[model samples]
Target chain A: MHILIIGAAGMVGRKLTAKLLTTGHLGGTPIQRMDLVDVIPPHEPQSEIDIHCEAADLSTPHTAPALIARRPDVIFHLAAIVSGEAEADFDKGYRINLDGTRALFEAIRHTQSYCPRVVFASSIAVVGAPLPYPIPDDFHCTPLTSYGTQKAICELLLADYTRRGILDGVGLRLPTICIRPGAPNKAASGFFSGILREPLVGKDAVLPVPDTIRHWHASPRSAVGFMLHAASMDTAAIGPRRNLSMPGVSATVAEQIEALRRIAGDTAVKLIRRVPDPAITAMCEGWAPGFEASRARALGFRAESDFTQIIKAHIEDELEGVQ
Target chain B: MHILIIGAAGMVGRKLTAKLLTTGHLGGTPIQRMDLVDVIPPHEPQSEIDIHCEAADLSTPHTAPALIARRPDVIFHLAAIVSGEAEADFDKGYRINLDGTRALFEAIRHTQSYCPRVVFASSIAVVGAPLPYPIPDDFHCTPLTSYGTQKAICELLLADYTRRGILDGVGLRLPTICIRPGAPNKAASGFFSGILREPLVGKDAVLPVPDTIRHWHASPRSAVGFMLHAASMDTAAIGPRRNLSMPGVSATVAEQIEALRRIAGDTAVKLIRRVPDPAITAMCEGWAPGFEASRARALGFRAESDFTQIIKAHIEDELEGVQ
Candidate 1:
């Protein structure tokens, strides 16, 4: 079966591509061909299967229809402007995130003959301030930021398009990924990973918020698992509410530090400097600490039970278990 | 203050126009001018204020910016394709409901000088099936219908635009309006008003579902009141959650009929005819039976307390108190 991966140049997309290459199959169907797309041409992965890589902006009018013409069996839509960038550039956010996503859906609808399983990467940022601890699946999306609003709008469109039989779609409101394996990115939630990732690698990291600041997280490996499951799951079980909040380990900054101390000793913990930036702190305040994720969990999606497991995944996958 | 109503020909828009004309002022500012826009030119209200009536489709290019060029102090965006029509005509729903609203917002943002209070008429359809009784203000919007999806998308945009300081926006999720003072339209929820309205006016009304089927409702008078309150309220008190579920009476079909019995006795009630329609009954089951509306009420937007009051409102306003 042919498969398509949008945003294939990003961290999750690259990892997912690697995972698919290793598995050699998805939903028990032998992978015969794959198409990967992004704003910049994604590095071609070494796979026996036919892999086509294209650098195209889906926001442009003809790009989406051109991509859909390939008719991949499963489409993983993981592309997005990160939280900080979207919040900073208003028109860019709407153009890339909202209108771009709608264009893709419309393209699929025009296909008229095929209904592909489309898995969308939504975000916990969709929920705004004054959050309840372990927020329920049904909590309203009052996005505090432009990026979150775009994600929320896409979720609505995803559900609607799926309901209309234009495409079989599922949306995963992924928690903030922990131990993100990369250099520091310009995301406000970067500290959630930087404090841990930097310390383990013998580098000092800044803690922008208080140690009491808690958040939900899952490993990069788990996120790939979510996409695969969403692609294969019996959608009838999901009913009309196609979007689900994936389960994740909820941990405070102090708890994250403690986990680091247990694994990499006090020297690693000492690398975390308590230098508060009020701007980051204020943005962190609106983010959720945890989620019920009852619907997602009930549907059989799983994640690391704790931050320690998350760190372990990064060590094994990114660090080659040399820590 | 100059005022603009986008859907001036509709019931709530007409009522709000008349209400503004009656008051002669809004937020203690004298009414200097009014612009009424719709698909067809709205009938000129008998008022001394300078009125500009335009028949324009907001979805078309240049229409929204043209409207914004008028520089109304407050803009009531009450235009939308109702549920049944949106479900049947997918393209029309997205073009008119989603794109049109965004165009108006973009026009305002481009102006960059003025920020007008934008009051949007959203619907309870934003909340989908398997609902909890008295759904809270923050319940996630999983719209089951295309109309609902479009409304939910607009609500997200409304909040985002407000946050970016493009416009001072407030979205009201109105309940099924009871005792509508016009001919039956194609709305799936039309029967909610039809059953009460036709029977009271000494005409036979069809009941599509069993009396046990309950739904949320507000009278036309109450709906007008909510818009007025939203136009005048200090948005700071609303915080970041711009979309609110307006307060209304929660009653079963039996309760509505009983209220009619109380107001106009058995004669009015006897005009009601029970004709089970499985299609409508199936549709009604997915609708919200009630809402908590705690936030809207706290912000001083009031509605009729019970179905009895709703019936009285229709009689006093539509029937000239003769019923």
Candidate 2:
């Protein structure tokens, strides 16, 4: 089986690509070829065989058909301009987030003779804050931010195109991948884990929103699992509504502290310092807490059972950098 | 106050334009100027000032800004390629329904610093077949047709823009205008009234759907009323979610036959010919049976009370056009 992973250099992208390579392929077809595409070509794999790692901005109209020429049986798209960056920069956001994503879909529509599973990485940001409790699978999407709006609009387009038989598409709107393994990036939510992980390792970190503020989260491992499952799931079951909220833990800032104390003893809690940034606080307020991921759950997607496991996964993966 | 009515040559457009001209302006401002825009220019009306009837294709990008330069205080956007035409011509549908509408909105967005009350002529087609009875105000839009999808997307953009204070917009998703006050066009649902209408005035017409099928409807008078009321509604009270379902009646084909029988006696019923079209049946199956237009009713947007009223309205309005 030939596989393509757009945005393959990103954190989750690396994990999913390695996992796919390890498992090799579906139904006994080994993934003989792998196409890794990003704005910057990722570090070359240490494999003897060929692996196509090309650096090109996929937002360009020509990029999609070029990628489609690879004829990937499974296309894992994890590329996007993150929320904070998107909100701050209108042109860059719309360019990469909206036009780029749309161009790919359009390319697929015109190029593909046989529909392939287009596994899209959506985010819970698609559903905005101050939401109805236990937000149902089919809640009306009222995104509060540009990133969320872009995701929601793309979801609509995906559903419509799938209905038109353009491509078999599924949008997995992932919860924020807590304990993201990397150096602290510019993402506003980076502080959620930074405050915890940094303190656990005796490093100071900023706390943006209050500990009492709530959010939905899944670990990086689970996000990769979601991609794998979405690739194999029966799309006919999902029908025209191609998007689903990926399962995740709904935890408040207080819950994170409590979990830290439970998993790493009181030392982790003491490492956390209280400081508030008004901008981050206001932005966080517009986000939703829990989504009743009924549709995704029924379709056999899984997540960490508890926040303690989230901490444990961090300890295992980033601590050792292991699968 | 000034008013502009696009598609002023169409049935609803002409009625609404005439009504507006006779009624004068909203908010106690006399409509000192009127602009009628269509591909086919409207008939010149004798006004002390001037009646500006312009020939233009709104689907092109340049035309919108050029039109908006008139800056009519109340703009009634009734220009559309209709359902059957839109469905058959994909490019034209996207060009007019999606691109044209977006261009118009963008034109409004960029033209100086005036916020005009844009009364958009949306349709019940935005909501496909509802599984649950009484489709609520916040039901997820799962449009089954391209025209519906385009309209639904425009509604979203309009709400977002209004929330951003870029435009004061109101969208009215009108129920199928029953006994549309002229010889039937090629719309699949045309025969619903045509069988009775064409025959009542001594002409043969087709019957395309089953008697069991039920759908929401309103008369041309009500459709015009919807436009006028939408144009004048307290948009500040409407808030961010500006698109609304106008009040309408739910009636089956059998009820329509009964309406014809009651209003036009046996002659109207006898004029009805039974020749079913599967294509219409398929299309109609994807239409909403009824709507919970509680919001519109509460806000004072009125439509025909029942099928009998619909038939009577048609007889009253269409008598002169009849042979």
RMSD of every candidate to native, in Å, equals 1.1, 3.1
TM-score on alpha carbons, each prediction = 0.99, 0.90
Q: Which pairs of residues clash in candidate 2, taking residues 3 or more apart in a chain or in different chains?
A: A129-A286, A129-A287, A129-A288, A211-A253, A211-A254
Name the candidate that leads on TM-score: 1
True contacts preserved, each candidate?
1.00, 0.19
Q: Which stretches of candidate 2 lie over 4 Å from their true place?
A: A26-28, A112-114, A128-130, A204-212, A276-279, A321-323, B46-49, B199-205, B265-267, B270-279, B320-323
List residue ranges in candidate 1 displaced over 4 A.
Answer: none
User: What is candidate 2's lDDT per residue for B1-323, written digit by digit as tens?
Assistant: 88888888888888887777676666566778888998888876665635898888888758999889888788888888887777777678868887787778778888778888888888887766544556777666767777877787777767656765667889998888787756687777777768667877878777888987888889888998888778777877765667898888888889888877887778768877778789889877777888889988888888888888887777777785332
* Tens digits of per-residue lDDT for model 2, A1-323: 67788899999989887777777774456777888888878766765445889887878868888998777888888888888788777567768977787788777777748677888888887765447767787666666666877777677777767777877899999988888876777877888778667866767677878877888899988998899888887788876767898888999998888888886677667777678889889877777788899989988999997898998888887787332
Supply candidate 2's per-residue lDDT for B243. Answer: 81
lDDT of 1 at B258: 92
